[model samples]
Target: MIIFMQLRVNVTEFCIDFNCMKIPSSLLGFFNEIGAASRFVSRYFQEVVQPRYEVKQFIKQCFLIGYRSLPLIGITGFIMGLVLTMQLRPTLIAYGVVSKLPVMVSLAIVREIGPVISALIFAGKISSSMGAELGSMKVTEQIDAMEVSGTNPFKYLVVTRVLAATLMLPVLSVLSDAIGLYGSYLGVNIRDHTSLSLYFFEVFNTLKFGDVLPAIIKTFFFGFAIGIIGCYKGYNSSKGTEGVGRAANSAVVISSLMVFIIDLITVQITDVLGLN
Candidate 1:
């Protein structure tokens, strides 16, 4: 009987310990989210190739996502170049190599800063907007209603936005780079004298196919990341009104993180391929 009672106590203790053990809720939730996002991406690929392409919606999205974003991107790009040039001027002047300022600034902006910064800004504006728009539709049962009406909402919505972003980012990056170079020209003339033609000459002379191509190519991935993350977060959102805000915030955060990751990977690949 004593032995039986001791066994009962041990079982009770084990049950208590098991009950007291804490679950890794946050970690589990993160992994679950990752899985969900992966599945969403896979589904996108599958649906993208199917018939009944939404060509009209795709063009409309391109105009909205690309054309609407240009002014802000151009202004930011110009300021970035001007500020970067001004900041680097002193250092270059100290070394008496201030003439190399255009080359250095041009390479830095084209190879790294321009695409990444433009992408981040795009993410901040576009990703959050997509998330909020879709999340609102999700909460209001519009996405569901579309399904009931035999409309493929994901095709009309997610595919178009993603394609628009993917195609337009490279175009935006090109414009941003040009505007930035012009800003750098203005900056160079602030404390030094360099003609517009000379400034562009130095820029073009320094840039190569390797420098320009990889930079432009990566912007496509950056755009894809931003669009996909936004759509994924917004489409999967729950919790009604609160979910819209959460979706938008998460879209920006994740998309920004993705941009950095893709940039790093691209740099590594470029290094290996001797493109850098």
Candidate 2:
């Protein structure tokens, strides 16, 4: 009787252990991460409105995230416009409405491609950079040191980068639109003749405040999303050299996905509001 009772107890313990081990850790971890990220974002909003703002750090971040990023965005915008125009020309020519090319290309670039593409590029460059920088600081215990020294690391680091990204992306998108139009002009002249002034006049004539405003507004959200995600990933990184790379890679992936998601939401909102 004693031996049978002991055997029963051991079997019950084994079954409990096996059941516990069968739980999906990954799904639980993902939800926990989402909750953590939400809390982090909430903290940012709270800190951002408080006194003793980090103006200098914010300006430095603006220069680094915005000014330094111009060349890449510009080149990409120019090439995108040129390629889009060249590819579209054959189709427009086939339809025998090739005269509408300028308006069509301009509308496409200004309303959608310019903002979305510039944002993705911005995410690729800035998100990974922020993640890597913060991740390195985290792994090296610099963030811990900042806290120990009575400095508000989150306010200084995350807030500045987030604000810079929020402000800079719209400006970049505007510049990209202009450069893209120029590229489109060059593309138009490659196979057929069209005056520069005429091309631009047609482009501008088709554009309106409604089209430009919504597009620009969405970019602010995009920038904010990218900046916050990068900061969040890097700030919460694990304590290891490998954590730095993981943070950077995850930041890029998540930010890019966020850009698309934001774009989709914006489009839907615009459509519902009749802005589209």
Candidate 3:
């Protein structure tokens, strides 16, 4: 009873002190923005789950957000693989494991680097685009108009973008992994002679379901996190044109951080599961 009363006193004193302290206008604005974003994200999921699936809009978003983003991801993935292989070659040669280059590079790319690099590219492109587009719509009060017209803006806008990112990222990752491996192949050939069959066979032999599944699974989470955070930032944007810029910038920053965080968690889980 005494301990409980002391705890209550501490809590009361803390609240009193907090209330008595002067909160900077900037800090208050920050809290308000965070609250708005939290509410928006919660509503976004709820709105997404309701009846009336927006299939056509979803597909359109998939094309705009996912299909359009592919070229960038592809180019980045290829360069990533090519560069990684080239950079690592000297070290492998030093170890007299130059012939093992294809296998090692392929496994490294597939297991960790490819998906991560691709996702970062996706985040830079898609998250910023989502934020700016939605933020602009918000600023123009188009989103409000939709709501007033009995259209669920969250369902129509947020769900489609998030779902598109979620669905297409896996497909993109598969392509990126394949292309990255090909780049590694070319990188291998630049300084050495290895047949396509030999290079790919080595890649496949070294790569198991263990390596593939965890990496693939983590990308889904990465995509979802990026999409949701972007949508949340945009949907909750305020202060007109300035807010749009801030939203876009914040979306990319937050989404990229979340991707790395998810990657770390994935590595831990994979290790615990003995998947790698």
- As for candidate 2, its clashing pairs are none
Tell me the TM-score of each prediction against the true structure.
Answer: 0.92, 0.92, 0.89
What's the residue-level lDDT of 236 in candidate 3?
78
Query: For each candidate, what is the lDDT?
Result: 0.92, 0.91, 0.87
RMSD of every candidate to native, in Å, equals 8.5, 8.4, 4.9
TM-score of 3: 0.89
lDDT of 2 by residue, 108-196 (tens): 99999999999999999999999999999999999989999988999999999999999999999999999999999999888889899
Task: Kindly list the per-residue Cα lDDT of model 3 for residues 1-276, writing each as its tens digit.
Answer: 334435545545555688767656575555555555556666666777788999999999989877898898898889988999999999988999888888888888888898898889999999998999999999999999999999889899999999999888887988998999999999988888889998899999888999999989988998898899898888878998999999999999999999999999999999999886
Determine which window of 10 residues in candidate 1 has minimal summed lDDT: 1-10
Task: Estimate candidate 3's RMSD in Å.
Answer: 4.9
Model 3: lDDT equals 0.87
Candidate 3 — which pairs collide? none
